[model samples]
Target: MSDVWTWPARIGVLLGAGLFLALLVPILVIQIRRYGTTSPARLLGAAALAVYGTALVAYTLLPLPSGDLAAWCAEYGYPTVQLRPGQIFADIRERTAGLPLGAVVRDISVLQGVFNVVLFVPWGILVRRYLGWGLLASAASALGASLLIEVVQATGVFGLIPCSYRLADVDDLVTNTVGGVLGALIAPWVLRWMPRAKTLAATRGEPRPVTVWRRWLGMAVDAVAYTTLSGLLAMAWGLVGYLGTGQVPPDTVPLWLFASVLSWVVVFVLPLATGTGESLGQRTVWLAVVPDVSRVADGGVGLSWSARLRRGLAGGALWGLLQVLSDAATMFDVGALASASNLASWFAAVLVVAVPFTAGKRGLSGRAAPYRLADAREGAGALSTHR
Candidate 1:
């Protein structure tokens, strides 16, 4: 079976999932929050506004200047590493000085520049919505923000990450800013591409604007609840292990307590809790319940169960185990923002891999597919139902 799917396909699957979330989360949020108040036209407009607004605010409010970012980079264990852009470029230039112009651009530095641009696409979408700005605005804001962050890092205000962080490259500024603008402009077309998502409007009662704190709380509650399920399952595992071998793995911790903490974190800190509502934990929480209702041409009631079963099975007990395994693999690999220690990577890995099934109903499988939430409203609704 594994042979049937090449590594490229497997990698594509992972990348595709990430890309989907990156593209969908913004629009889904817009539809969920704004659709209820105005026409679908206005709703989308509002969503676009919110996305860009949030991005701008995030850029401004980011704690880069606190200088703690530098110290935060190296907390991971042995074999911890940092990516030095300037050093990498210098090495590249020295090694490939004789290469053709095309080859030079194809080298590591150029490739990294391209990725830097890609990494900030979400920023563009966000900036445009937040500030009523376009691609140029988004790009300008992104460059300014990145530069601020780099300056802070160079200053070592936040700590070690700042210390080892590289040059504030002009190229990075150019690429990242352009990426942001493209994202902003791309938003409307992207939403139009989706099959029309049924949205609630003021007619049904204007959906409350989701506050940052409330959104976070909702996620927190779901995380705790899901983790509880994991705990129960863990107990079942322990009981079976005992029945079969009359022994327990000393290396293992108590399931009840561990799941409790994990679920708690899933709720409070995951990105989904903040907006996307598609964090590994949040996604599982969403799968347990059905989304909103609507009518057919004849006004027949219906349910959008397109991905529900997938969500459910993925969020199930066995799937939870797989979630943990995948997360463990993706931890260091997913977002490796290492301070000197690489603690963030380790923690992220442990959380992604072990957190779900070890204590709750959601696992790696659910996370792999995640909950297909479109906005904060749907996310909240999903959380309520998932529990």
Candidate 2:
């Protein structure tokens, strides 16, 4: 019982909570980016799984035992195994019979029994709610999990150590399985707080709001592709400079200008070649850039090519401007001013990443221009002036 309240044990619990938060944040971002919405139930479900895993590791492996197998053999004798069932129960009964109720309740063996059952209860709830496992299946899984833990302990962590430091007890299996069953029984009441399957599938075949995450993902893909193209072009320019003047490239403004032009064409013009407005990230994440006709014309059904070109250029110019500023910021010498510039550069990067979240689905560039970014799958409906 003292071991549970020790500093090490408390740290383990804190780590488990941290793990829960760590898992939740990324999951929320991914969900918003891909689905334009998230299920709170799913996020909590994932957090529960992470906490459970952390707890499992803490109990099984933390506060490692001391002394090597050879040392133990010389001092206490060779390694041994305990295969008899009911021996723990028999010993507990014999030891507690003469003791008072308070003493019996305070015993470490009794406390361990309670801990084993409590530890596995969450597993049952998580499996039932997330994996959709039935009562019997969860119980079987609990038993299998307990068996694996016991097997590893009995084998001295599969020969890493000389002998078993922890005892492989049959009582743990019974308590853990019961805990799992108990959790499954309570899942029905707890599941009401989570999102339903229908809600999750709502955007499966419908036009969803283009989220900031989606836009950022598209930007990331485009950035990589643009950088690769820029690098090749820069190498060519450097080679030409060497051939002409027998020296390295004298000016990089041309390279930056060329890269910006290439970026604009790739982002705005190349989409025309593919016959789809989706960049690589948008394609992978099932998002598309389409014009919102209602905002484009006074009472028209679709946007003209001129409107799209203006919208594209508006967004592309800002992106190119930001890129050039970021590049220039990197060339500064190490000093207070340089640090401030770097901080501003980081702020700019953060602003770029965060703009979509604040600008709604239209994003910064689209909101600044006459075009609206929407689901590409809207097909003919996208071109109609239907708000």
Candidate 3:
């Protein structure tokens, strides 16, 4: 029994970590765009949901036979499909005959029934509370999910394996559905403090002050977006090269350089060229750059393409230079270049952190440009009219 749980627990943790990392940027972007700010509770809930999903799969269908599938099935005598309803009660009674009520409750057969129900409780809670489903809908969803799991088990993962390794019991379906209903009933109390998605969406258009934390979050989003874009471009480049030449390109330096430049163009340059004056990350976090009227000669109204480009370059020049140096150092394996890149990286990080504390709340980028960051909810016309 302990072994049964230990393996599943390990699998759940490993898969959960990978799932969390993969979903982190998407979650952050969604929350910021929908809510106009990040919610700690929502983030935590998302992380919990990921873990629960992995654990559910781990517990229900894991620890498959490593070798000699037919021999293993014969030796272990895998159970057949259990179609009888209320079979759990009979199993419990038979296993704990002549025992006290407490002993019966504690018996392995009874505990198994309880565990099946408990395993799906999180599904009910998440669907009802996080998903905002009605009780009936939540219960039905649980039934469907449980039925699917049972079908998969009975079919040996849809016939991938030769035989079912776990029992597909009708009693489990009943208990799991009951657990879902119970969870739906308790969901309100369990998630009373969680913010409603509707409320967040309704206020998403309202203007918010540009704060240090908001700026930092926008920067973080940009970094993640850039990194993701660069990786994707590199992969595509390699794939194309492999298909055309029958082998992947030998030197990755050119691919890396191309990907980095293209990613920068998409993430930063395109937005400025289009006159939005916002990076992908800034847009996700509801921020935009508007011309600072005091410094602009044209009264800061409807910034021209040249002006926008200038602002973007002013803001990103130093960091962009540092990033190029870093990339060069990495690609060429030069000790002096690597040391310079490291120092520049650290300096850039310090500037990002420290400049936010200043009176303007603009980082070095903002200070360098004749533009200031404003909440996207504040229309460009309104921001341009101000300092």
Candidate 4:
């Protein structure tokens, strides 16, 4: 059946289109090498390509209104800047209203199960083929993935990633697990029924393919790229202000300083989120403070919404207050415009800023998600060798 094309569908189509087009070259090569590129095989090959292409195009054309949904939620102040745990459940209840009722229709209408089961068909294909995990493992992975998408929407997009937003509700978890099972059960047949097609499902490498620390290091490299970009922006701003103003304005200098400090928070620091806001940096570099060895065995970082909130409040409040004090001190001037008291206060504030980086477990980097990255190349290098 043809799909109702939407903007997201178009984007999804474009992404897969390049790969599908690439597949055409392989068919020609396979035909030339094996047979004389004759009528039946060529026709069959062309038919297979057409079917695969149709499935992909149709999948891309589906009316998955994710962006519109997010915008709609945003219009209602759903993801408020500040939030609480209860609101999380409230959102679940609300989003639950329009959930696809495929499971409910299974008794009388088998066709409905097609829609219900098909909704998460990829989850099964992913787990069984790529992840090579069992039913529970597949369910857990799906739950984690779905919860993460919600959390990112809440925290990064909406800025309302509250405890509930960060959490996977019991209802949603069960529903999502069931959806995953449905998908898995339906996947083998989906592949079989795909009209003379050979589709290889791929996944984000985890087990024997890529080690955790290596992935962690790659994340660190991305952080460095972000930092470098921030630095270049700062440099350009300084040059532009100097050229336009004829002389660097007094305010221009301070803005640069502030940008320099804050840029660290935006780029290198935000990636280390451990569901509870204890970043990878804090977990590894400041391991003495966050004590996240348990997260390692759990196989992922950041789970509990409460933990994230606590870490964010404690770390953020402490860090923000300290930096503000520094700003105040930096701007302060004595009666003579050169008071020793002011100078001393500024120095004291500067020293105080280091307190978080040295706090309990010294998980106090307060630099946000950047701790592990800053230290791994230096500290963990010697430590990792023993492993």
Best by TM-score: 3
RMSD to the true structure for each prediction, in A, is: 17.8, 8.6, 3.1, 22.3
Displacement of the residue 29 alpha carbon in candidate 1, Å: 11
- lDDT values of the candidates? 0.45, 0.63, 0.77, 0.42
TM-score of each: 0.32, 0.65, 0.86, 0.28
Pairs of residues clashing in candidate 3 = none
- Candidate 3's C-alpha runs over 4 A off are 1-3, 6-18, 67-70, 77-79, 243-246, 252-254, 297-299, 302-344
Candidate 2 least-lDDT 10 residues: 329-338
Residue-level lDDT tens digits of model 4 in 177-242: 567777566655654433222221121111121223323333233334444655676667667878
- Worst 10 contiguous positions by lDDT, candidate 1: 287-296
- Model 4 — TM-score against the truth? 0.28
lDDT comparing candidate 4 with the true structure: 0.42
Candidates arranged by lDDT, highest first:
3, 2, 1, 4
RMSD of candidate 2 to true structure, Å: 8.6
Put the candidates in TM-score order, highest first: 3, 2, 1, 4
Candidate 1: lDDT of 33? Answer: 40
